[model samples]
Target chain A: SQTIHQWPATLVQPVGSPLSLECTVEGTSNPNLYWYRQAAGRGLQLLFYSVGIGQISSEVPQNLSASRPQDRQFILSSKKLLLSDSGFYLCAWSRGSSYNEQFFGPGTRLTVL
Target chain B: AQSVTQPDIHITVSEGASLELRCNYSYGATPYLFWYVQSPGQGLQLLLKYFSGDTLVQGIKGFEAEFKRSQSSFNLRKPSVHWSDAAEYFCAVALPMEYGNKLVFGAGTILRVKS
Candidate 1:
């Protein structure tokens, strides 16, 4: 089966600190990658998605960026963290065929204080 | 633009009772629909998906959903509820081929089971 691994499962950073959240899938190839954030009591919001290595599409503009250095490895970065950056961050991947269901990562709970 | 609406924020039902959750979507074409479940502190799990075929789709954990294009609704149902079924359910829609398979999700409806 496919498994998604996300690191630093829980993080707490000071304001203006840098941020990096990693996601990697272990059982698929050429999968589509995505990043989503969910504030408490809110729905998941799409932040970024990648179809392949070096190709990224941002759904919303903010202080974050995404990179796909390898087929299964994706990274979300920020130069300076803001208070509003604290949320549940999830990484998901899907086969680039039809409307294949997306599999989500365990997710990282970020606390920016 | 593509959007999904889950009218109910929370619902409570007794065990062994029938369950139904409503979902509605807005898109230009035949939107691809999906239902997902999320346990506390876990990622979203795909329960079922509707792409192009039959309107009624069966999913894991004894859950099923029906797609009604005329009503722009895809409602989820369970014949009998169990305590283990207490979780958050999400309704999502993917715009045909125009959006490159991006899924737009609605505010999830949380389900609570009464013993």
Candidate 2:
């Protein structure tokens, strides 16, 4: 069974502070990784996705960026956080096949004040 | 462009009652559709997915969805509801191969179960 883990289950950061959220998948190798954000009372929005190590694609331009340093590890980083950055961040992975069904992690609740 | 619409924002049903949730999507070609469930403050769990072959797909937790291409709808249904079934349901559609397999989600429908 594949499992995705995200760190810092909940975070509270001051405005202009740096941000880093980590996501790693166990029991799967070379899977497709993705980062999604869900604002309060809103749907999930794709922020970034990675096909392999050192490859990251940004779906929407904003203050954040993503990096895949390892086959199973993905990191979302920001030099400075904004108030609008507060939201529930999720990490997902899918099989690198034609039929891709994403599996999500527990997610991190980030509150930027 | 790909988009999804879940007409109902929220729905209430009694235990043991039948349930149905509507979903619609707009895409240029054959779309990959999925239904997911999310408990409050938690991540999404895939209930079912429709890629091809089967128009009616069965999912976990006694949930099923039907894909209607002509209508551009993938509606979820449950034979009987349970209190534990209270959660938010999301309908999503994946863009064509040229779009990098990104999923566009609907606003979601919150399901409330009455005892």
Model 2, A1-113: lDDT tens digits are: 88999999999999999999999999998888899999999888899988889988998899999999999999999999999999999999987765478899999999999
Report the error of model 2 at residue B10, Å. 1.1
**How well does chain A score by TM in each candidate?**
0.98, 0.98
lDDT of 1 by residue, B1-115 (tens): 6789999999999999999999999988778899999988789999998987889999999999999999999999999999999999999987533455688898999999999
For each candidate, report its DockQ versus the true two-chain complex.
Answer: 0.65, 0.59
**i-RMSD per candidate, Å:** 1.5, 1.6
Per-residue CA lDDT of model 1 for A17-77, tens digit only, reads 9999999999889988999999888889999988889989999889999999999999999
C-alpha DockQ for predicted model 1: 0.65
Could you tell me which residue pairs clash in candidate 2? none
The residue ranges of model 1 lying beyond 4 angstroms of the native Cα positions read B96-98
Model 1 per-residue lDDT at B84: 96
Considering the two chains of model 2, state its CAPRI-style docking category.
medium
Deviating ranges (above 4 Å) for candidate 2: none
